[model samples]
Target: MTNSSGTITDKTGAPVTIADDPDNHRYTVTVDGVRAGHAAYADRTDDHGVAQRVFYHTEVDEAFGGRGLATILVKEALDDARAQGRKIVGVCPLVAAFLKKHPEYSEATSPVTKQILDWLKR
Candidate 1:
């Protein structure tokens, strides 16, 4: 079931919520009101000067492992990006793996480039 705040109860009955915290440059997921994980990203201008969101890391708290929170987090993050008209780039392993299995996002996804990696280093 879903709550008015947009939180949903998963199969385990854990109430989960995902929201973008742009100040932190990440989208965070909370389970039962506790932060479970976040997908970190950076906003960058691509070769064509189009703004894109580069997801470079994702992690869930060890206590929350195996809850599929990462998948939930990434999906919401990607959807939000698309809603905002930002192209997606998955540099993080989890995000890349998710993208591979979810082709519906292909048109909104951008290939990871050396320039993006280099920008991340700084």
Candidate 2:
């Protein structure tokens, strides 16, 4: 998973890379060297604390969706965050929903997610 030049090639020659555009606070994920997924966020610091509000999106290409490409993108996002020691604010409904189903990923959510438990209310 080397991010050299913002690309990671799989063993079968399929490459997936993620890019962080600090100016826009967006990250694009590419598969086999092609754009397959994306995530955007707003980073802010205030009197309470600093937080990164995030959202994720994936192309509807049949070749990508059915293959769990979005999940892979989420995994990559989590892995990247782990490496960078950052907490996330899951503003994307899909990501927020995912965190609800996977408690192990709770740490990946923002500090306030417990209060945002609308998903669990049902």
Q: Rate the local accuracy (lDDT) of all candidates.
A: 0.90, 0.59
What is the Cα-based lDDT of residue 114 in candidate 1?
Answer: 88
Task: State in Å the error of residue 27, model 2.
Answer: 1.7
Q: Kindly give the number of clashing pairs for every candidate.
A: 0, 1
lDDT of 2 by residue, 32-56 (tens): 6677657765554333664444454
Q: How many clashing pairs in candidate 1?
A: 0
- Give per-residue lDDT, candidate 2, residue 5: 71
How high a TM-score does candidate 2 get? Answer: 0.63
Candidate 2 residue 82 Cα shift, in angstroms, is: 4.2
TM-score per prediction, in order, is 0.91, 0.63
